[model samples]
Target: MIPIHENLKGKVAVITGGSGVLCSQMAIELARQGANIAILNRDAKKGRDVIERIQTSGGTGISVKADVLDKSSMEKAREEILETFGQVDFLINGAGGNHPDAVTNTETYQDEATGKSFFHLDENGFSKVFATNFTGSFISSQVFGKDLLQAKAPSILNISSMSAYVPMTKVPAYSAAKSSINNFTMWMAVHFAETGLRVNAIAPGFFLTTQNRNLLVNDDGSYTVRSNKIINGTPMKRFGKPEDLLGTMLWLLDASYSGFVTGITVPVDGGFMAYSGV
Candidate 1:
């Protein structure tokens, strides 16, 4: 069980992609702190499973099948959440991942031996990733920000990545989209400052999640070449866990902890950003 924050008790939180590995863990942790969870996902079974876990753990929760990229889907999700939870105290935009097609097999650009390089990348694939990471958050905020603003201390937490700070080797689309999230966080914070709604992002380092599990870990359960490089660069010399993010998550949501803080993308990268790979 995770530590419970006093301020989170009885609060309402809506998490997009809550059925996934990391976000589901976030949902569970928030539930332990007494927040009413709304798990929004494209997969009905996955979302329901998360709700079951929350309920079994003695917390209030509901699963809503919603596609983050669709504005109408988000509108329906907002209605369902308001109907069930009464209010949205916090919003977590956690739906986004990199596609294999948007990534290059080779790190550096090559003249004759380009492997999934920029020229070979699919335009449709690039657009899809951008829509999910940046556009989805934009529309979801539009739908949920209304109700969040009604709460005494409204907060919108976005899941950014270390790639946003220092673009990773091969995932250009993911990097650009996450960079947009950081910029949008600042824009939203400033836009809603007078309304007492805080906007911030958590830029996490490499974590073994379903989205990139194959990329980081091999079929034999060994670390991939990229994973080894990441570990070596990190001061901690290890990958992060879902639990590692809870402290910052709670601090950003609880007004007492960060009443004056806003527009910051806090890196939870275990010194990955600090090291210059010397």
Candidate 2:
């Protein structure tokens, strides 16, 4: 079990995309701290599995099937959670991922001899990524921000990426979307300052998730060329694990620790953002 925060006990944390690798771990960690977890995701079984794990560990939680892009669906989820958990004290916007069609095959325009150039990238793919990462957070915030405004020391934690700080190769859509998240996080922090709502983000580096496993790892558990490049670029010379994000997460969620902090995007990137290639 992860470490618990005494302040987080009995708080309600609504994690969008909580069934996925990283966020599921976040949900569990928060649950271990005695928070009531409400998971919103498209996959019912996977979300229920997370809830089951929480229950088995003597934690309280529920899974609500909802799409972050649809405000109505998120509203329904909010109502369900409010009915079940009383109120939402924390909002973790974790629903976002990159699409293959939005990815380019070449790092630069000059290296696009294979016809998978940026010019050939699908517009729909770009829109999907932007909407999923940026707009989804906006709407979820709108839906949950109500309870958050009234709850004790409410906070919003956006799941950003290293791509937001510096665009990663071949994933322009994702980079742009996350960049917008950083901007929006600051905007919301100021917009809700009077309401005592703390808005911030966690910019995670490359962690091997199902979505990017094929892109980063080979069949034999060896790193792909791209993965090796990432490792070399990281000052730590290794990839991050889901647990790497927990300390920062717990810090940001506990008002006693981060009461005066807001509108910042903390990097959990294994020094990838600090390295300048010497």
Candidate 3:
């Protein structure tokens, strides 16, 4: 069972990309803590499915159709959330993914490579991936800043990645974007230091989610080459589970647990960050 944080009770949390594998788990846990959850996703139906899960668990929630890349859409989502929950106490910037065109087929550049390589990566695709991960967080934070500041102890938790610390192979755009997120998290935390609005981030290690399953797993359900590398590099010898992030998440969101913690990215990587191949 997910541990309940009493301080989170009655709080209102707005989670972008709530329908995603990781964020959906976050939404459910937050709701279980008695927070009113507002799930924002481009697909309203998918968002509603998460809400249904929350409701089934006897938690309060609503799903809103919102595009993280669009300010007007986020503003509309905010309005809907306010109408239903009255205020926003937490904002989880969780909408981020890489485009296939932005990823290189090979880990390094090759002079005679036939497949998509670093030199052949589409500029538009790179821009889209960067904007979706970094710009989306910026836009959502700005839209919800005022409401968050009004709350007694507001917090903004961003989803970062291991790639932010060490650039991963074959996904230059994704690594760059997540690196930007780490810097942005520190900047925002300092910017809001005096406002009682703490900002932090959780940098998850390799997790086999729908978005990354193809890269990590083969068609027959065997680990891919890249997946083997990740596991071998990690001291735990495995990928992280969705539930692995909840403790750090709850600690960061509940002021009582992390009131003074800000401008930091906690890695729940099962010792991946600490391990070094001998």
Candidate 3 regions with alpha-carbon error over 4 angstroms: none
Taking all chains together, each candidate's TM-score versus the true structure is 0.97, 0.97, 0.99
- On residues 96-199, what C-alpha lDDT tens digit does candidate 1 reach at each position? 99788798888988888846877888999988998889998998899998898899899999999998888998899999999999999999999999999999
lDDT of 2 by residue, 92-163 (tens): 999999898899888888752885789889999999999999999999999999899989999999999999
RMSD of each: 1.1, 1.2, 0.7
**TM-score of candidate 2 against the unseen true structure:** 0.97
lDDT of 2: 0.93
Clashes by residue pair, model 1 = none
| Highest-scoring model, lDDT | 3
Considering lDDT, where higher is better, how would the candidates rank from best to worst? 3, 2, 1
Better of 1 and 2 by lDDT: 2
Per-residue alpha-carbon lDDT of model 3 for 173-192, expressed as tens digits?
89999999999999999999
